[model samples]
Target chain A: EADIYQTPRYLVIGTGKKITLECSQTMGHDKMYWYQQDPGMELHLIHYSYGVNSTEKGDLSSESTVSRIRTEHFPLTLESARPSHTSQYLCASSLGRAETQYFGPGTRLLVL
Target chain B: QKEVEQDPGPLSVPEGAIVSLNCTYSNSAFQYFMWYRQYSRKGPELLMYTYSSGNKEDGRFTAQVDKSSKYISLFIRDSQPSDSATYLCAMSGQREAGKSTFGDGTTLTVKP
Candidate 1:
């Protein structure tokens, strides 16, 4: 089993508020990714990290920012929340590019 | 057209019925195919992963891949209520294995 965790299982906040979604894995993985998913929709990659100090933007464009200061911690930050940002954020980690990605429980955000 | 296509089926079936989920891709470069299951308010869990082609069976789940047809299938036998969830199909190539293309998930309901 993958030991990945996300904090704030559910979050509801007003527009213009800042929020941070936390993701951490104990698997000592080198490749971590962040995906945005709407209900029943395909997952869209937002950001990804190769390792510590190596972060890259994903296929989808997003206003959120991500950081990779530690190998195990990968956090996503939204400077100002909007209704459009209301969706589910999923975090996954894998040992390498060809490895299976294990996901967290996900963090649901509602920007009202 | 999208690279991966999956029928966003809200398929419902009774317990003990056989469930088949399928996905077709336009990209032949994709060598890796995967199936994931996501519960309500939770992240996706990788249920099966296949490299190349052929059929792989695990317990009550069976995964089949036909690279020539650019098609993949997932079958669940003796489906139970706990098997109800959104199923997602993802694929990637050897060049960029972690940058997978995903299909819109299919929602399934298994009634007991």
Candidate 2:
């Protein structure tokens, strides 16, 4: 099956805790993206990767960092979580720059 | 001003009604337009996609793009209770299509 997966659909943790959100896709897509979306707000691009060993920061600045060691994996790590960092993280992938995108279930993180 | 603008509406309609969702963008470079459906606490699922200025249809959904007017629309016919979700509009430029701009989703509820 061609799909993208995100681990820990829901997470709750105290502030200042370090956390990593995992995203993997079996579709062999060249373009992968991570987006942050809050309630009733638009999605903000946080990070993206074109392929293995290629990663770039998106339009929105964030304290989180992403690594694309392999083509299938793109993980986002927050050095220290804060209460203001609580939001849903979505993962998406596409075959080409102008193609349609497929999304994963997403991970909802809560920093108390 | 924002590049893309959408009405974040909590629109309610009876079953079998036709639903219309719209989005406007300030960037004329955008040539790839898409519509996505997102359930509560779920990732967005692609519903329809169109290139340049034209209409594309699948099942009960139709997506329209007007590059000259810098506008796009999605129409859903015979709305059902299962259609209750948030509709999002996204677009990217043809030359620079890797990154897509998304609109603040419009929440819709279909009653029986």
Candidate 3:
């Protein structure tokens, strides 16, 4: 089974508040990713990292930023949350480019 | 056009019924194909993975990939009510840490 985990499975916060979503994996995967998904919509990739200290923006434009200081942890931070930022955030990891990705339980954020 | 396309279906089926889900892609370079199942408010879990063409089966689930047509399918036989979830199709190309492109997902409900 995948050992990936996400913190604060559900969150409710006021607008303009700063929030951080934590993701960690015990599988020792080298690559990690963060995606934003709305109900009934496709998952849009926002950020991804290749091992430590390597981060890149994904296909979608996102206000949140991610850091990969350690191989197991990838955290996403939104400086100022908004109503539009209310959506499910998923974290995933893979051994390499062509490998299957394993995902965390996900975090549902509500920016009221 | 989107790289990958899938029907956004809230399809309801009785238990033990056969479930067929499909996805089409425009990117011929995509070498890896995958199916993921996500429950309500949860992140996706990798259900199946296929490389290039042909079929792969795991228990009640069968994944078929037609690289020539850029079409892929997942068939679930004797599906149980526990199988109810959103099924997403994802694909990636040859690059290391290649970002995956995802479909909108098809929601399946197997009612007992």
- Each prediction's TM-score against the native? 0.96, 0.96, 0.96
- For each candidate, the alpha-carbon lDDT, in order, equals 0.92, 0.90, 0.92
Q: Once superposed on the true structure, which residue ranges of model 1 sit more than 4 Å away at CA?
A: none
Question: Judged by DockQ relative to the true structure, which candidate is superior, 2 or 3?
Answer: 2
Superposition error at A30 for model 2 (Å): 1.2
Clashing pairs in 3: none
Tens digits of per-residue lDDT, candidate 1, A1-112, equal 6799998889999999999999999999998999999876789999999889999999899999999999999999999999999999999998877647889999999999
Superposed model 3: Cα runs more than 4 Å off: B96-98
The interface RMSD values of the models, given in order, are 1.4, 1.3, 1.6
lDDT value for model 2: 0.90
Better of 1 and 2 by lDDT: 1
The window of 10 residues in a row where model 3 chain B has the poorest summed lDDT is B92-101
Number of clashing residue pairs, candidate 3: 0
Candidate 1's DockQ is 0.71
Chain B TM-score, candidates in order: 0.98, 0.96, 0.96
Candidate 2: where are CA atoms >4 Å away? none
Per-residue C-alpha lDDT of model 3 across residues B1-112, encoded as one tens digit per residue: 8989997688999999999999999988888899999998788888999889999999999999999999999999999999999999999888744468899999999999
Candidate 3's chain A scores what TM-score?
0.97
